[model samples]
Target: MQMSWHRRMLAAATVAAALSISALWVAPAQPSARNGTYFYMVMYRGGRASGPVESEMTLTCFPEGGNHPDPGGACMALREVGGDFGRLKIAHADCTMEYSPVTIKVLGKWRDQRIKFIRIYPNRCLVAAMSDWVLNFP
Candidate 1:
């Protein structure tokens, strides 16, 4: 059976649309929390996720590795509070009158638990002030 050109084009279009829709429905794979390895993707942006990204890094703990410069220091900071960001101690820092707001986002699995954190700081200085070093991705 010979198919017309128009019919072949229609079939291709349908397949393309189906693939696009399915891609939208697909979710990324989540890491297991029992591996004793904590991985976090940290992002610093001018606003929300849609905003321009200023800095980003991959931080992995429990072996203290990843693209992060001071992964050991960063992991130590997290360990101080048992991977609890809320309990992190903030250090004092000086800054100018600049008002560049930086939005930080963290997502990962931490020691048998899932971690998702997001906060907007008035400037980069405040993020540096956080002794936790979790948000200090450079």
Candidate 2:
């Protein structure tokens, strides 16, 4: 006896549905994509102890959040300067002028533009004074 055309079509549809469901279940899950700006901040010493020191983090802004511990404060600081690191101003406080030699690097994308910022500060105290606690890599 031959299988009816209607029965064959129904069987094919059922198999297709099953395959589709199984494919959904078998495929690996993925992490949600991050939108807005992404930044990498690093602070390190120079000379004999030329290695990472103090702090380091991944900072995200605009939508405002990231792997950084103080995301809210960092994001707010960035916003205050219109995302321009150079424009960040120090608060009214005294800071020592001693020389220690530390380097800071901020590499990332912001507002669809690539950012590469590197600066050498005399010490952590000077870095804190100059950066207004923005970037939060300290």
lDDT of each: 0.73, 0.72
Clashes of 2: 0
Clashing pairs in 2: none
Top candidate (lDDT): 1
Each candidate structure's TM-score, on Cα atoms with residue i matched to residue i, is: 0.67, 0.63
Candidate 1 minimal-lDDT segment of 10 residues: 28-37
Candidate 2: segments with Cα more than 4 A from true spot:
1-34, 47-54
Tens digit per residue, CA lDDT, model 1, 71-90: 88888888888877767788
Scored against the true structure, residue 57 in model 2 reaches a CA lDDT of 72
